[model samples]
Target: MIKWLEIDGQSSVAVARRFARTVATAAGFPEVRTEEAVIVVSELASNIVKYAGCGRMLVQWMPHARGYRLAIVASDKGPGIGDLALMMKDRQSSGGSAGIGLGAVKRLSDRFDIHSTPDGGTIVACEFLAPGLGLHPSIELAGLFLAHPDEDICGDRWQAWEMPHGLRLALVDGMGHGPQAAEAAGTIIDMLESHARLPPSEALGNVMRDYRNIRGGVASVADIDASRGEIGYANIGNIASMRLRPGEIKRFPTRNGFVGNRSAEPLAEAAAAGRGDYLIFHSDGLKAVGADMLLPLHGHNCLLMAAWLLENGEVLKDDVTIVIARVHGRRTHAENG
Candidate 1:
């Protein structure tokens, strides 16, 4: 599960620390890693309140080759650092800049990355790895999700699996907010997990036949067959799916109806996929705006790209989620051989 928090004052530091520890522990982090997570989260939140005056963070237990780990992504619109290299020095900012904890945060995280610009802002991503995971897929993927400010639970859910052919990614949005919506969205996630062997359209067909106790919602699913170098896609309702190439984007079409209902026949189609292509899917919570245009900035890090899009493109009062899957060539196969 992912939790999003806004740091507006010193009060937020404790809350962020608690959230990190609670979620990290739930994700099976060892006692040592959980304490490290708490310390890192506190430092990040304190620096935001002390330097930026205000900022936001997205914390999630994310999937990794090593295991499900805690990922902290913090960003702010405050004065952006002009020199990131200088900021990474071991010295503190002495209460005048935004680089107070960069060196320490870097040291604490297993993986860390940052992007700062004078015109835009700064985004810092830190990841901590656990000890185990089940799948070792060739391609890399990540997603970020949050509930509406007015709601307690998110109504959007997603899941991905390393299929025999390649990767299968699915996202579904419930009809509305609150418990019922969360249940509806969850139904589809469970369905996707159970129906992993089926193709997108057929699996969705199974959902239509067997779904129960939940209001209908939109859904989109994609199967990327790296061996064939193509993607098979299917969608229903308002979820947006796009194939993001380096300089161009091709949006996949969706039928106009709710997914669990007698909606439209979920037709599946195929398209060529390059080694570096990114296939993205999101609910109506995020508009299909210019996320395509910013590919140059957030393209290399799918987790950061997902976080950036959710933070910037959210439609104000709805649940939002985005999944990013980058197609890597036959690297896993080659490594095994």
Candidate 2:
């Protein structure tokens, strides 16, 4: 599960550390690794209190080739670091403490990245693998899921898997809110996972065929070719899909009709997605404002970006699910599997 904690003051640091330690333990991290994770959390939480004054952290468990990993994201809307190079140096402390926090975090993490803009904000993302686990290069995946206020289960679902072409992704929003809606959405998720080898259009068609007896929903699917810097996508109903680059935002149009009930064959389309581009897919539960606001957070950690959107932009009237993915390095044929 993805968990979020707010960091506003000194006390919040302890809370954040406790949350991180608990999650690490639950993920089966060894005592040594869990202690390291706690230290990372303490340092990041302290940084938020010392520098940003207020910020938030997101912690989640991610499946890896060898074992599981702990993914941590810390973000703050404070004055951004002016010289990241200097700050990362081993004894360089901007907060007057031993300058080893950020550096130590980088050394302890299996994967690390940071994005900051001078007045915009700072987001630091780190991943710690389980003891004795080997690490593999991977595409970053991050998203948020929220059930409708009146329903116990969310009708929206999303998933991603590596494919021979690159990566395959899908987002589905079941017709209504409640248990029945969740079942319809859940079935679509299962179909996507099982039939990931099929092309987006064909796979979507298969979903439509299998969803005959269930209440229909809107769906969008995409095939990302990181090597070619392109994305091929198709969709039906109101699911929104978009690509955000440095300054430009491009929106993909979805064909009208519900997936199972009444739907037209969605014509697949292709577009350019460069190294720093962001691909976002979400259910209609998000309003235009919420969707538009995500543009400024283009290069941040995918999970942090999704969490920010869910926390600030959600309408809360309906179930919401947002998936954010960023194209990084090319994956080899072996890694693609």
Candidate 3:
């Protein structure tokens, strides 16, 4: 379960102390480790007040087969860190500009990762391993999309895959919005990643069969070939996929058909393509407008753009999601690409 906590100032300090005691007692950590945990909480809570005005925190303790582990996440929709280096350099910000709080927190934790956008706010996550515990590294990506503000449901889903084939991207947006409409879009993502390498059409067929049990979902799947400049893509329904090419806005739109329920089969054959593809998939949230309107924006800035678009009521009201895959050599670029 997830516990949501909101606090500011000395109250935040007191609450962190109490919460640390509770979690430490339940997990039976050594007094030294417990004190470290408390300090971690205090630093995080204090930073919330000094930076984001106020913030929300979440704590989750999951019991392992051997013991237990803790995860903490603090988030705020405030102006994000514009200069990560200045924020980390300790005493680097001009005057008494609240730099120590973040620098200290960074040094106190075992593992930490922060996601921030000039427009979308920020999320800081830390994971603590109890004595004698260990965890493998993991990767997570989340995308959200909404339809035209006037529309009810947004058609899109984001999924993660870890396999020998590397990471795969799957997104689905149903035809419309409502519980049923959302279910439809969600199901496409569900079926595609259920197996290692099932043909996209077969996955859609299976999802359609299952749709009888639930509503249906529309989806698109792209195999990201990180080594080569290529991506494999397949789509069904009104959802669209595109790659931001060097000088072109290439679009791959699936034919019309409700996934699962199968309103038509002629359009259900999978659409597959080769490399050099900057894959983009969306429902009607995008018209003929291509990535030319989008590619110039920095990758991190793209999400901020998404958040702003959602806030300003420019796109459809339905949920909206955008995924960009830049096929590069095996090296990973940490600059939010």
On TM-score, the candidate that comes out on top is 1
> Comparing 1 and 3 by TM-score, which wins?
1
Model 2 C-alpha lDDT per residue in residues 194-264, reported as the tens digit of each score:
77778888888777766664587788999877776678898888988988776677888888887785446
Better of 1 and 2 by TM-score: 1
TM per prediction = 0.87, 0.77, 0.55
Count clashing residue pairs per candidate: 0, 0, 28
Q: List candidate 3 segments past 4 Å from native.
A: 1-85, 91-142, 145-156, 174-178, 182-187, 205-214, 245-248, 261-278, 283-293, 299-315, 324-328, 331-337
CA lDDT of each candidate? 0.76, 0.75, 0.55
Model 3 lDDT, full chain set: 0.55
Task: State the lDDT at 86 in candidate 1.
Answer: 65
What TM-score does model 2 achieve against the real structure? 0.77
Task: Looking at model 1, report the run of 10 residues with the lowest lDDT sum.
Answer: 328-337
lDDT of 2: 0.75
lDDT tens digits by residue: candidate 1, 1-337: 3456889987887888888899888877889878887877887777778767899898886643244656788888777887777677654663755443678788877767777667667778787777554334557677778787788888888877778877888888999987788888888878877887888889887887777654888899888887767788988788889888776777888888776676457767777777777888888877775844456653566777777776667365788888888777753332221
lDDT score of residue 300 within candidate 3: 31
lDDT order, best first, reads 1, 2, 3
